[model samples]
Target: MTRRKLNMGKNNVYMKHWLSDKDRFADLINGSLYQGRQVFTAENMSVEDGEQGLVLRKTDGKEIAVQRYRDIMMKADDGTRIVVLACENQDEIHYAMPVREMLYDALSYVDQVNALRKNHRGKKDMKGWAEFLSGMKKMDLLSPVLNIVFYYGEDEWDGNLDLHGLLGLDRIDYRMLKKYVPNYRINLIDPKKLENLECFQTDLQIIFGMLKYRKNKEGMKNYVQNNRTFFAQVNQDTYNAVRAMLGSGQHLKTVNAKEGGTVNMCKALEDLYQDGVEEGIEKGLEKGIETGIIV
Candidate 1:
């Protein structure tokens, strides 16, 4: 494969090496974003006009050119292409209502190009975001479908965001686009959950092993104190496997050597001591100096 490269910045200025990784991540993200459903096709990346250039083509031969200056492209597994446009930064509006106007110009040209090609393509929508609230009011949807993807993750997401209803398909202002374009579902991938799968697997497994080991040590110590015969009844292989399963040394000297479990016991005892002190103080105070005859 001739690694086809298109510069997303002026004069073919190369981005950091991580951009290649970001591009690959973009693919997986799109896949995961759409839940493994096809939603985008990516091609013709350029940035001469200020943003990268992208061609979003659908399986039916319909295509749209999304200027990358303000938008990003996501090619789906089923050959659907989604254009993600950012109009907001740091909880502030970046673009005004001019985005709806820009859509008119961009999509008008897309329609003209499609007409000339003797091929009509897939439905296209605009993904929009802004720091200030801009709307999809002025777009000429009669010419082409108009859909907007708005960035809703503002700085203070106090579970108080209503941008969805403002931009949802049911909104009266968005009725035109809903009537024309097939509304693609938008789902947020919790950034914490979307971290690398390997990181989650390894870190979680390590923590789990540590916890299991701690539990086994506590259980073994309890058994030794109470049912002393339990250890003698077990085979050598069983004993070793139990120790290995808990990620602990089998040697008697090493078992419970660190007193890690004892820390938990100590914490509980401290809580009990504090509780007893509080009760004793309260009980004496409730008597209200009765022994002194001051009541």
Candidate 2:
């Protein structure tokens, strides 16, 4: 397992704040903009209510009470409702349930709400939702076409389990989030990210500002110049993109992310080279001493 060295720099500290605010960060990292209102509920409801009467069978006597429930709804800014259901802290029994069964549980919630609000409340048989539900039910069950997210902590999950691998939504799930919940649409928000002191320092605002500035062609060019160092650390493809932007020769107003400064990619590369050389020398000296038998 390759361990990542996390820098406790000002920017990383700020990342913690966004990480800590699970609801808030969930909106941001979800690749979905934070336009919808986030709603949490502990109350449960179903499509049909159960009666007080219970029936017993003669052959193999048994009694059961049937219940119904609906999925949680997140109302979006455009007045569209998203049906979201979360199943967490599931134990052995819940885990033993087939994926389809779990999905059915989520679907039942949507069904109950759809049936109850068909006319008097909300949009009656919202066309989009109806089609969406149908697709969920009729689609190939074994292929894993679900968007269930799982939230877990660091110690709880092994790195081998890729969250996107579990959900089969690689395009939707980003590289960072794949670290947790290796199969679900859910992201593991480190509680420590919330406690970071730098959150109050307006790191999110800075990131948001950069995102906003990168909207237009000229702005994007300037953003590349400002973030040359960061791009260099990423991949060659990313570096080439930045280089293209810089070479585009489009004049844009300088963003105040910091100030206009040379990235010195060669310097960063040199530092890495020097560190490797030092490590190699140290190892060689240790090995030589061990073999000399001068003790």
Q: Which candidate has the highest TM-score of all?
A: 1
lDDT of 1 by residue, 1-295 (tens): 3322221121112111112223333433344354434333334222112234448899999998765333322222333332332221111222332343354336544544444333212332323453112222234222332223322122223231223333565767777776665323222322213433332221222222322224344544443434344333433332322322232222221123132222232233234445556888888877768677346
- Model 2 residue runs over 4 Å out of place are 1-77, 83-281, 292-295
Clashes of each: 24, 13
Identify the leading candidate in terms of lDDT.
2
Task: Compute each candidate's TM-score over C-alphas.
Answer: 0.26, 0.25
Residue 203, candidate 2: how far off, in angstroms? 9.7
Q: Residue 210's C-alpha lDDT in candidate 1?
A: 29
Q: In candidate 1, where is summed lDDT lowest over 10 consecutive residues?
A: 10-19
lDDT of 1 at 230: 38
